[model samples]
Target: MALQGPEELGEPVEESEDLDDQDASSISPAEEITLPPGPGGDEETEEALLLPWDRFSAWLHCICVVGFDLELGQAVEVRQKYPPGTKTSICYLSFPDSNSGCLGDTQFCFRFRQGSNRKTSLGCFLETTDRDAPPCLKQGHYYGYVYFRQVRDKSLKRGYFQKSLVLISQLPYVTFFHSLLKIMAPEYFEKQEPCLEAACNDIDRWPTPHPGRILTLPIMGVVLKVRIPTSYDKPGTSQLVQSAQRLTPLIVVSSPPPPPPPPRCFYPVFFHLQMLWELVLLGEALVVMAPSPAESSDTVLALVSCIAPLRYCSDFRPYFTIHDSEFKEYTTRTQAPPSVILGVTNPFFAKTLQHWPHIIRIGDMKQAGEMAKQMKVKKLKNLKTLDSKPGVYTAYKPYLNKDEEIIKQLQKGVQQKRPSAAQNAILRRYFLELTQSFIIPLERYVASLMPLQKSISPWKSPPQLRPFIQQDFMKTLEKAGPQLTSRLKGDWIGLYRHFLKSPNFDGWFRNRRKEMTQKLEALHLEALCEEDLQKRIQKHTEVETVDLVLKLKDKLTQAEREKLPVHPGTLEKLRAHIEGVILTLPEDLQGILHKPTTL
Candidate 1:
């Protein structure tokens, strides 16, 4: 464990041979004491005695400073539980300057400082007749620091603190240690070899320190000895009582406080499961190690609660992906990316704790609903099929590139008595291609809208659509439906029948019958009108042709009709009619007859 600067300076130095008797006795350091070695062949180590005012974060100070048992002692012993490889700090907590009503920026504390001359820093001093009196004990609480060196030099040290600093609440170091080793040297655990030495060799060859690599063998032993009470009954005092009762034989028990209310944030047996949840949120297809019940323990239950959603993300589990070691090996037998190559935990896992936030977030029902909503979202309606769209107005614009000039000429020709055929033909071809192109996209646009509209129609109410869109679709049923109804009915009915047969499309297919009927009826009316116009044009042409043949029979003389030379009287009529009939007659006859005869 890394030491704080002050902690190193305060290491026990036997009375500096050059000091005065009173001063030297008061300054005994902590590390000089000897203790029995446990089975591990390692001497137990202890930390300097500390007070409530010791160097700790504000959160830690608040957790340590108040509400404790104080009858036989004036200070409460409290231990800090740190992550693996981090040392446990056993400090004596007490309320100092009790006269002060509220806690503020400059709270009281005392610390031992080294150097031949520096004085001890303490929040308060207690007067005692027998030197063991608790003058600072008040209102059922302790209010001073204990000098551990003096108590221990008298061979009266208690709890695990007599030898080593291990918090009762620290996590089991072995499981965490293996989890760390897996992150640092994954291939070692993946090997089929059952020999333990290979795993150790792999750990020895680890390239660098992993994020969770703090749990070393030595720390594992200390963590094993820690025995945290299963319950918390108060803010700061209950844990102290638990430790004191276990370590020292001298603790007196008052009635224990009722257990603290259960917090809603505990997520148990979910280390790897939570990790997989993170990948799910990231939308990654990465493989991970499967979660197992044995991976969890009480020590990290609070931490798991902090980092995982617990219930909100449960839906993501079915989609979570993972692979075993053999599979990973088989796949990587060819090639693997750099990220996959690194961070291998047990050949099967490229799982990492990187970028996981320090604090856990609890997800709400609304957030889950939003996720489901995204899943519910169908592709939007094809706006191309939407009526009154800008696309309709702009439809002919692309083909109108040279149309302005041509249109101007056609209008001029109309204003004049005659139009040029060359210019008219050019304009006609341009419009034909423009009409052709528009029909193709329009048909495609309508076809595309069909499936999209069907898919989204059911989800339309809450996520509302536009007025025309929301209303019943395609309401173009003729005033009187198709007079010849069977063909039109068959076409629309075919569409509805096809829709009904599809799985899961019943609701969308529900209104198709009425809509298709309306559209087909409208189309039938247009077809009937077109047919009527063509009949009128054909009838008018037939009447004109018969009239012209009758006129020819009355005026042409039989000789002209038979193509023989006409009589002078008929010739005179032909001459008089020549100018009017020039356009209608054969060019040769008109040219020869129209020539002036010698008068």
Candidate 2:
């Protein structure tokens, strides 16, 4: 069973055992008291006696505590003391070692006071096997402890009690001592600064102190002492003590290293070259215009020579020439005003005379002549001739007479050939009528049938009528009457005689002329009707061709719509087809098809 401490009881024992006791003791009358020897023989001396709070104080001070096993001969014997006439009850209190074992080396025994008289009460006893058993005692050790007590104030009518204790342990006396000093005596610790450096030096000089000689220091205004195992610097002392003294405390607070310098910004080399060129150009310009003649000449020559080398530099040449030309033109034109040059024999100084009239004395001829010579030698001319011959026109006369003769022959051949459609139609309609009906006279046809020629005599006519008579006619007429001959020779008589002789001819001519006029009118009507019918057929054919084209256009539009890929289900396939179509299309057409489509 575990042993209980005095704090659990309502009274204190009158008698208690010391380190010489080995058995239980009788109780006494006092409320708080120490103990004397019991029935057991005094096997352990006071030198080996461990204080009640030794292990506890050692742990509180962060000192290492040694552990032991109860089964391995590690145990503490305890005996309780209680008062007379008290129905005493024993309770065991056990404290576990730093090891995981169950209260192996630590134990306490308590005897509780009973009966109505509360003054005669309880007692406690504590002991360690380390004193009696060689295996239980740890070597090179320090210990600390805490004890709890319930004290009654008899002066008060009512009694109250609470727990209190003192703790003590061994620690390295160093700069860190202020922390432990504060815990021990906060008021005193606050009043005085701890001599940490001196104490640390002392600990370095003397690492181990004498054991069992408890060193007392105030703990919260109460005096307390703690025991520590002593270590020697001699040959047999453990190295663990030296290792602990040499241990260096680590500090973790540190500052971050400085950041790396900002990177440099580097512009490209071409930028430098460009700036250099510009500066050189500006310097050259300033040098050329410097006031001194020797200086200006030297500057101009240097600049020109410098630029001359760069003439083969493709890009530099054009730019330099442009700048040079512009500068020269500006300087020259500014120096010579146009108004001063109209009738001036020497235009070079005209501008200088007009603008800086006071400075332009006639004595500046040498400068003007030098300038003029420079201009003549260096100026670009406007009349730049081409390296090619002039163009010439060669004469070409056509023979008009031969052309006219050829045209006339062509016209004659056309007229002699078959007539054209219009000419044929006109001749068929009016040729016979015009030649016969219109040309023949109406009176001649009517008079030709009369017998005037027989009625007139051939010999009784005037002398002019004799020329009309042939020799055969006169011989035939020799036996005839003179009236017959005169009738034949007379003008009116000849017409009547001819009409009587050719009566059948007059009738046939008149009938043929009338028939020709009637046939011509009929042919004109037929030709006009045929032409009208041909025009109507041509118009109908044109209408048919127009209708066919319109139908073809409609069909083509329908086919295009059917082939369009607007349907929802075939979108993917349509896209592929469109890509193929684009590949097959001409570049111009493909540009149209590949254009972005809006939703």
Candidate 3:
């Protein structure tokens, strides 16, 4: 609602009661003007008097004076609209002083009283002895009038009334009788003079008192000052002075403190790692082939071995070539690993690795191998790696130069097989001898290497030697066996099909197959060690694998460019299959397989 201005508060009156005449009279102004006993007033005692006009003025002032209401909340603005009158209900008329001249600042607070049907606007006013007239007015005299109104639902309604009067023409009497007694009990009022004086002085210079005394009292707003004496000079007197000061006009009330803020949420590390792995898997494949002078051939080989495998797994197929000459030159110029070169040169790989940690470590090979074995036994026990198939082994098979000779030996062994009992005995004997001759020695060797291997910290040790040993030593043994045997056996058709179709097995049929297998084997062995080492190795493998995959990827690209349709399709299919296999692998393995780009 809009606020009303001073001009809108009340209407001006043409006439008022003759307060000036009543105030000017020297003789007893009314029948109620009875003088108290004094040394020279009267020789006999006089009856107490009652003056209707005087009582009316005093009552009007008490009700309508522009002063604070402790129970109600509002500011008082005193405005004299009419002079004092003889009318009992309407003697003097004045508005609450909006600007409490030299007293203190106040605010208008409106409250609706239940069942009273009245909306009251409460406030306070400051009276000053600094006025032009004497400190107080005489008894039976009227000074001013006041009327209060409240705003209710946008309408102004009259609430209360007050009329200023001079029952006594002294500042001390007017202040004490009208203000002090109304605000405080006589006892407290009498004792707090010094405190009130000090507070009044303190607020005299301020434009408006902040944290004013009236604020400490209910519905009173804030008081700036009060006139009182300062008679406190002794030590204990100061304490009493302070207590009295705080008791009324100099009251203090403090404000409350503010509240605290909310908490933050974040993604966990495992989830972050998973997202990174997925991104890396989506990037281009890389493979490193042996350097050669023929750029096209080298590119084709690398692509076939590396890029083709991952291309099938990821959505984006990247094909590029690094010629043997270029590779050699690059390597010679920068002594970093092939993987580092790939990571640096390829933006996709570099970006992916920015989120993934490097995991490759020395002990990873044995761990990886063991893990692979356990996984195979648990998930694919019926399958074989190679050399375990029937009709594939014989004494003359190794010496023979043709496939026909191996087939002949296998047929002869089957046809001339011993009677059932004799065959069983021979098998038992063979098993015993085989365990003693080969398995025991292999076990012993591994056992011997255990302590030295265990001593190596994955963090500080060099890359595991398992891949080189497996490829060079194991493969040599297989190749030089007494007979040429199939690497796989026993209902192996399904296993072979699965292995060949798997993304991990992509490009294995090519010359790069041996190298990839060796690398994979080494990684698998490493992962078989401690779980921590396995994790580290898997990370490393992902990086190296990505590099190798990308290198072969370039070859696949070259093949595609040369319009080698059959080779390109074959490479693409293999890449897809290998990628699928890699996805199926454990998280650690997958992490190893998928290397993100490095920064």
Candidate 4:
């Protein structure tokens, strides 16, 4: 497990922009705790040992936090009192370094405990209200013993106890410690303030495998390793053993040192990047964390084994495969996210993409100009492209209908050796392949992503952003761009790498307004292109129809010799073939052919 430290996370924490309207400064420093003068004159809660080295008087708090392995929206800790579920699991990170005593700076490693292998009863002190009712053990809770020994052979009978502990917030020890952190280091114990997904305003909109969110806790530590222990192996300095628990201390698996953790968020030693999903989709895992959020912060949260990976997919299987080492038995106690594993073909994922704020059309000026020309042909302007729908695999609907009467006039003029009606129909049916291939797809793509432009972004709109959020505010405050962004190129890849990594969090949001404007312009341009396409295809079709008319006239002379009527079958067959040639041309051409015209 490549545990992350503060230096590795490099992210300074910030409150959610969504909560900006709420009093963000509501957090006051934790109330002062008075330490009882004991043998060492140190303050120690019944649950946590105080660190005298730091003035903050921080407690070495060992918490029973459940990782939000599969939490859809809210933080998993909100379910702290509840039993673990699909998106929630028991993760152990604060291992007791026997050598470091209580407060010393010691290395940390993160491990996940495998869940119950079988349905077993948990025996606890439960009082039955009815005399006839029989005593029964709870089905899911884990019961275990925790040992505490005095650093020095001091008070309270050598200060050692093998106390049975229940992993429940309602339990005394659990409550005391939870209360201790709440009172002392209240920031961590306060409501879990996870940053929103890059595009979504809340967890309700979070999409799986969309982008890696930087999960940061208010506190900081380094992640050493992630392990799922199997057999009874005592910790480095204790005789503690277990049948199903894997919270062993300091189990190091040496590998060629992994690269430093990403600079976006400060991850505790317990959690690290499980998988770089984009690479996973491409069947690889290059775990060097880049693409920091446009927002500067030092913490990212994560859950392991809660959500399911896209099974049988080489791209996502690696996420399940990454564990401590071969020495330890790997565990898969929870399933991956349902929406993510459902496959890219899922309509929901495409819908999710629409909400994601950073889909870019990286086309340069030349491409934009070319697209513009398609939208509005100066000589042949007819209709706009924006009216049609967008897609590769999403909702798509056409916007225009071919003029049937015009086609009939053109076909009649040709058949009767007349020119005017034939000319009108030919001109109207132009851009045969362009509409089928380029126009509709471009329309679909734009329509699919239009939802992003309409989404309620946390960063204010440019007009709204001007008063409170200034562009490049960091330059005024820190004299440089965001640290992570500075390392990236100044283009779409850099901006797209992490939408939040834009110069200022607000700047990032406002920058998108420009793109949205361009997208709208493109939509209008598409409308123009649709019109131009019709005109151009009509011009081309005029030539083809004229040629066909000449051929028909030649056939007429031959028919005059053979005394055969103009072959209706041959004309119908030609009309059918031409009808299927382009996306919308068939209908117009067919109408022209099938309609009767007097010579």
Candidate 5:
């Protein structure tokens, strides 16, 4: 992954800013394990770096061993290893309690929202959980990734050995970590702790992950090729790695990568594709029932990613079981289900979560070629008749009509024997376009809030955003709504109204408002800089001049403090103008301005 030696992992460095208070709360204390020095390490160096623990903690918060306990008659975390830190309770997370009782081996992913008890700590370079609403900048919701594996083991009492090697990273790199664990977990089970140390050492050598670039990550001798997503990326912009091995060793497909996993989940529910997209976008509480943990997690993850670019503010768990800590909290019939998407393999959930509005019951996925012929949406009772077949079960109607064009396109691809990757790309692109169409009207209306540049004045405070009126915005949407670009048309206005009530809308609106406000401030600064500094100073009295300078200083300070989106060149030019005005002033006035500090 890199030319750097083992010493790089041990080198003392400050903790990354990305690992904020909320993330640290999920990192519980594990028994600290001491290890021998690296190739050329000394006692002081080992102490400084924390050795393999530091290496492991760099990419993973901790390594957990969760499996069924025969003696306890329940699933329990057998052992866990965490870096040296103040201990905190991980009770907030509802870890899966039962193993996916499949044959040889199966892998899947799960996500959980850590409790609201925010705690602060140093170290751990976890990415912000939701890119749209960074926990460090916004609320204290941290999401954890559980990469689970279950192997059939006759030696064990349950006839299977199952455990999850969890990564407490805020990053939603579902596919990447699954591949890493596929390689490491088997070795971990075979060789135990030493294997973990070796894998961590390899991870420590990986190059820093950056968007729009292909990253080559190595773990336990397997190499992974992945491309991180940039803000400008559209769906189908990146292709999934063509891994040679069935057990993907090192493929990290972050951001809009379309292929194998998500498409596979959709194949069984292909007819309800558009409806599934709407459900995810509307933040509906969805329950996915599959035959195993592998399918359950994959399906849920796929559902969550359907409305990407527009973050799904609601929480989701890929492979949930009745034994999870939140099982009762979620299954309680009295209260309406929370805005969450849950995936479960256990048939018990079919009855337990029957009250949930939307339920997707999918059987084991057939090969893409085999599934091509049976792509049809079957209508069924929500829960009473779930046992009869595999299809979408819901009473809620979709806002938009089914896009017959997309259906035809997918069908055409299937008939042509197009590769599964191509079909996936088509689906991904459709979702991306649908989301764009949905957001376009909102974006246009928001853009109108900015006042004309001529009205901005250096003497006046930054202009306020014209308040957003829902009714006014709706009226304008008559000519320009989601239907402007969308092929499917229904109550486009209704979709927008429903979205306004969602957390995603609130988060998006706040972020956009803040950004616009910053631009307004920057514009004011630019207007001030355009004036002749000497002429402005000469017109005002000494006191007025001093006050003006102070105001300018304050504006500049605030912009810098907030890290406003102003051009550096403009800021520098403004600073130079302010300095010129100060130097030209009378000695007494200069002294007053100089008393504080230079610009």
Candidate 6:
């Protein structure tokens, strides 16, 4: 609700004034009219009016223009939404750094993923703000894809129109969002608010983005085909829909197009892939310096995606500027860099972030074909960005030896004039295999923590899981690590020890523990269902029977709340059995039990 400019110049003025004229009535200059929720009478009509953010698949939330107004300086010029009362304020997202010095540049673009420093649930986050205003989705973060454009006009006081088209969304589908912005930004500069509304309507038609299913998304007369990844997917396996397959033609196409191939973002840093892989897996701080924002974001995203199947638990900003709030904290020499990956286009960062351990400086990847034709596999030099060539620059050595076979394969592909997509597939498989090999020992160790199924009992609480001992796991790893299976080997034990201290490892372990605990609960419920309830009740003393009934009721309620899977009619049968046992007791005792329990 903090609309950052004067009422006359506020982003909502144009849309509101236009509506007021059409209706022949007065309306507030700053507030948009909220469309009422549709009734359930007509499903197709309701679906047509549904806002993109209101949909279950809510890939987009809001669209706005952030620019330099002659009078207001950096301000949100105009904002447009379908239903218009989304409640969430994107004013803070209009500009990332209050003092981004590079704003004067004629043409540039960058992206930012914004969220709270620490994770919190919906209730906790809502408590700190106006309770009525909630985000469109159940998520803690949102992404902003910005396209900045400036041109000389020589007719106005500043003699130029400078603005950025900002697309805000809850989804982290980086490649898709950026590609959509590419199609909309230039056209919006020529036309205006109508274009934004058209784009939003197109987005509303997209189906729910369930993981692993192919999605056909149409926007601005182009249709994109993609598949969002699930936890089980390997790196580069999920296509982010970087390219549009076709225009929406009158003739129907028979077969759906294939999903867009994963981007070859790693081609620029091909020689130092293994070293970068080690840095990413250990969650080290890295800075990616590129010729422009597009390259910077792509490279940073690719680096983060290196260890897929294992989520990158640490913070990462695909496009970070010197104007960012954390600029001072990240650049100060007194402390080491935090575990993060930042993409930057400014030359100023080369000096400010000089103390950082790892840096990858890359040129324009648009000339990837030319680079492939000219270059070959070569040794890398120490990372020096200020006056050095584009290459990976890091002093820290890697634990595993570089796999010469993979290198040879990639180099051969490059020499053969093979497409970037083929090179990407080959590299993706290598990393996927590497991650699996590294994780096998950890998987084998955690599987040993489960209590034996036969040890479960209907008359007692479920057995606790065995605790994970690092020393015991290391001893196991010594005998059965990647050394037995991997062609490239160095200090597998050392690598595991290093990774154990990272955020990714902690997150993975917690998830595994939660899953195992749930399985144990389900097994306990199964055991109770299979027991002869009447015989078991008769065997126990009166006091013991009462205690068992109360505990069973509590456990059943919890299992239902958690939606744990159990045998059919398991809960209903137990409840009926409890009722029969209580009725068979003395009349006075039955009354006493009935006062506190329900069957």
Candidate number of the best lDDT: 5
Candidate 5's TM-score reads: 0.76
Quote the positional error of residue 241 for candidate 2 in Å: 23
The 10-residue segment with the lowest total lDDT in model 3: 256-265
In candidate 5, stretches whose alpha carbon ends up further than 4 angstroms from where it belongs are 1-58, 73-100, 115-149, 152-158, 202-253, 256-260, 263-268, 365-382, 411-418, 539-550, 581-599
Model 5 Cα lDDT, one tens digit per residue, 267-291: 6577778988888888888888877
What TM-score would candidate 3 get against the native?
Answer: 0.15
Candidate 6 per-residue lDDT, tens place, 6-39, comes to 1111122343343223221122122222333211
Clashing pairs in 6: 383-393
| Per-model TM values vs. the true structure | 0.15, 0.12, 0.15, 0.17, 0.76, 0.71
lDDT by residue for model 3 over 66-143, one digit each (tens)? Answer: 323435332222222213331322211122222222122111111010111111111000111111111112112222
Q: Which stretch of 10 consecutive residues in model 2 shows the poorest summed lDDT?
A: 254-263
**Which runs in model 1 stand beyond 4 Å of their true positions?**
1-27, 31-262, 266-360, 363-599
The candidate, 4 or 6, that scores higher on lDDT is 6
Candidate 2 Cα outliers beyond 4 Å, as residue runs: 1-148, 153-158, 166-599
Report the error of model 2 at residue 180, Å: 14
> Among these predicted structures, which one has the highest TM-score?
5
| lDDT per residue as tens, model 1, 332-364 | 424432111111112122222212111121111
